[model samples]
Target: MDTYRTGDEGRAAQETSFRAHIAIAKRYGKPLVIHDRDAHADVLRVLDDEGAPDTVVLHCFSGDADFAAECVRRGHLLSFAGTVTFANAVALRDAARVTPIKQMLVETDAPYLTPMPFRGRPNASYLIPLTVRHLAEATGADLDELCAAISATGDRVFGPW
Candidate 1:
């Protein structure tokens, strides 16, 4: 489609879109939930140039340890999903280990990225425990403690319900 074009037109529009979103979030004092797949560098660049909101959550973070560290340094939150528990997610696990517990949050990303046992099928909110448990194990943090941290951080990022 139009977004799939390789020329400068689409690229400019994409950049403009990001800038506008960032600007609106900044002006309104709203937290940003970033969905960055393989565009970690581009997303970070935009955030850096446009100035990120006070709180930025990298939803379903897919970067390496170094990128994770950078996000932490920049004071952004990193939310991990079921992919961190995948057999081939060594890099993702590594990132989780190094990310401070206070700066991390667990998510199910329901209807997608189902945890190991439930893979190849649709995921639901009830499956969050599976992801949270994996995150605790990977981070070497006590299960209860990790759960508490995730809960607290999520509340702060999205506001308490």
Candidate 2:
């Protein structure tokens, strides 16, 4: 088989792997939970090309408002993590501001990306409140309401626990 890799070898490998992953998600009718650290643009492009799953989530989303708006426009979900609470995460905070409650999710990303005041410390699901609280504050939504909405969205996307 003839192969033509573009850009760089790593990029080509990622594309190939993403294609396979999309296919599997389609086959199983499952939502895709993505961990996007610094590849928002490429990930968006690939999803656009391959047609995103019925429910696609950008877990630990790390993008600016533009990316968040694009994800909202594309009907993809964004799961906010401890990064949102980082004092230096201006862009991420901006993204959270633009991310509506209905399209929002909250996660701990435990053992890593722990929220400030507890940075570089052990983390667990209990730490979700810190992230969620920050998200609520950033989005200007009521804490209880935001949590409920996130829970509902999670159930909708993952089909319940």
Across 1-161, the per-residue lDDT of candidate 2 in tens digits comes to 01223445577776788878888898899998876656777787788898888888888887899999999988989988888888999998899888889999988877888987788998778888888888888778999999899999989887788
Among these predicted structures, which one has the highest lDDT?
Answer: 1
In the range 1-161, model 1's lDDT, one tens digit per residue, is 12234465566777788789889888999988887766778888889898898999998888899999999999889999888879999999999988999999877787899998888798788988988889888888999998888889888878885
Candidate 1 wrong stretches, greater than 4 Å: 1-9
The weakest ten consecutive residues by lDDT in model 2 span 1-10
Look at candidate 2 and give me any clashing residue pairs.
Answer: none
- Residue 160 of model 2, lDDT score: 81
What residue pairs clash in candidate 1, if any at all?
none
